[model samples]
Target: MNYSKKIFCQPLLWVIALFLISSGCQPKTEEQATAENRETDTESKLEPLTTENVVEVLTSYEKEHADSLVLISTRHGDIKLRLYSETPLHRANFVRLTKAGFYDQGEFYRVVKGFAVQGGDSDTRTMKNGAYKIPQEFNPKYIHKRGALAMARYGDERNPEKESSSHNFYIVQGEPKTVQELRAFEAKHNMKYTPQQIKLYTTIGGEPSLDQEYTVFGEVIEGMDVVDKISEEQVDGQNWPHTIVPHKIKTINQ
Candidate 1:
């Protein structure tokens, strides 16, 4: 009877020892799961604050407001501009700047005969002055035509490539349309225009050569006469008027 009892007790002791070993292993498993869960939570918390996420948000905003329009009031007159949906970056940049009242005190700094009128320099935004710059957004589809508004950049002399200044832009007016004139302009600039584009320029009249070279995000919608008036202004060597003409633009609904 004593031997049977000892045998039973020995097997029960082994079982108890195995149970303790298994219990100890379970704590490691639980610790590992807890660590993995913590890592997952940290990653989830860090996700949306990334730079890529911020840029995505801004890009989304630009897409939403692509077709917005703004009205430009000048001492000459008022011109309504329809911001193009195709050129999302340029459209959003312009809208953002205008809403910030960046152009409130800006003057038309550069004007040229039969070419364009330019403004939006940092020097233009002044109590005395305010300064800011935007990125260039050059789109080939939008051309410089009658009432076509585009950004102005320094000539390729220093820039070498026609890189645009974000703040400065121009309005193209009554430039003559001739094949020879087109050829001469293209040849002089070492640029090329498509046959269909050339045909459009000759008939419809535009600075087609300027397409894709500068950011053209908007066109004069209502007050093209105002653009014409400003385009016709007299200018000095710097392309600035002897009298400073103040131009103010306010954005309305698209």
Candidate 2:
């Protein structure tokens, strides 16, 4: 497989594993993956947050919604996104972070061309600001189409509920697929997408297998080329950009 196709396939494999996790299919020990991730992210005892704290924050922001367009200013270019009103919890968290300048100067640390460019954690800023989880806000109205803005979270072993991370997010740069390709995914992964979703995957393109697994709360309204460019940038062994590609996000009056 070529580089872009290879990158796209890796995530689908993970999604398949997630599907299995839901249906009593065991692929890898969730314990191993969770342990590795924990080692990668050393515990920070400072300003630790609780579920109650997160719930309280969610309650206080019930009325908060994205009335203005949000722009993620990146080194490649600005990516304008429209947060979906249907997914209020995820939308509110994104809007709150953008307004607070939490994403400013953050680098797109993980970039996989034709897959995603992930950011929202610049030097552990979320932890310093008191990080918390948001309940899964999966809406059928949203799918992982190219330019889709979605939150990233832990693997199924640790996050069985599919809870989303409070800060980290990604923009999809997925490629279009044929009906045959999608059917193979359905058979291998033991999941299915709606006919409309399948149509979207075969046309405009997206990681269709990720539809219900991740929280896709928004989509790029402009500068999709920039997101694509970021995905294609040179990266290190870890898929992190060779050089910093910073993202500065803010709320703009429409």
Candidate 3:
């Protein structure tokens, strides 16, 4: 036997046998492989958000995203909103969407004069129906005063838990209510009005009926005028504006 040929052939056989063993020994299921890929590749794909993962994802997102102010630009004017830090989930979600350009060129689709200027139903980037709904972050300190920024939600009939919509929001253009009116509302709704709510509703004018029903997460630090203009836009009987009130939301100081 030739010793050189034997050595080379032995090494080649070992290399081929090792390759087969390595490939066959480790078995990964589809889910395991996908999970590993998602873990390794964090830059490209986001984990699919569901009821189970929403909290974890948002919690992780909140640590990095510290944006507390957003600007909604429109033809009418720019509406600057100061997001409340108390409502961390809502604040973080808004910041995330704004950073993702989810509200770009969106219309104030529903403008109920003297009530609110509801938007975030952008023609381009509207969240699909049955999307993630956030838990209610109701604080007695926050009320539906004029220019109050709040999340819209389904009625208590379906949304008894009062979860807020993921994207749809409104800026109140509340019609002033009197002390007596507020008292009546309190009696009818079985909700007590806070001193702060009473004072703001009486002085600045706001829809007191919305108190405790919706999550007021922020307020208009500037551009109430723009909100007023949007609310006054002409609408058909369905509350939809005849013309589009396009808007773009951007995160600032993130």
Cα RMSD for candidates in order:
28.2, 7.4, 20.9
TM-score result, candidate 1? 0.64
List of clashing residue pairs for candidate 1: 125-130, 126-129
RMSD of 3: 20.9
Which 10 consecutive positions of candidate 1 have the poorest summed lDDT? 1-10
> What's the TM-score of every candidate structure?
0.64, 0.76, 0.77
Tens-place lDDT digits, model 2, residues 180-252: 9889877864667789988889888988767777789889999999988887889765565777788889888
> Model 3 reaches what TM-score against the true structure?
0.77
Candidate 2 residue spans exceeding 4 A from truth? 1-49, 124-127, 184-195
TM-score of 2: 0.76
Please, what are the lDDT tens digits per residue for candidate 1 over residues 1-254? 01111100111111233222211111112234334435444333122122124335436768676547888888888888888877665676566557656567566765665656666643323221111223456665566677787766533343445544434566766454899888887776466777876776787586655655566778887887776677677865444577776777677965
Error of 2 at 100 (Å): 1.0
Q: Which stretches of candidate 1 lie over 4 Å from their true place?
A: 1-60, 122-124, 127-136, 154-163, 180-200
Off by over 4 Å in 3: 1-48, 126-130, 188-191
lDDT of each: 0.56, 0.68, 0.69
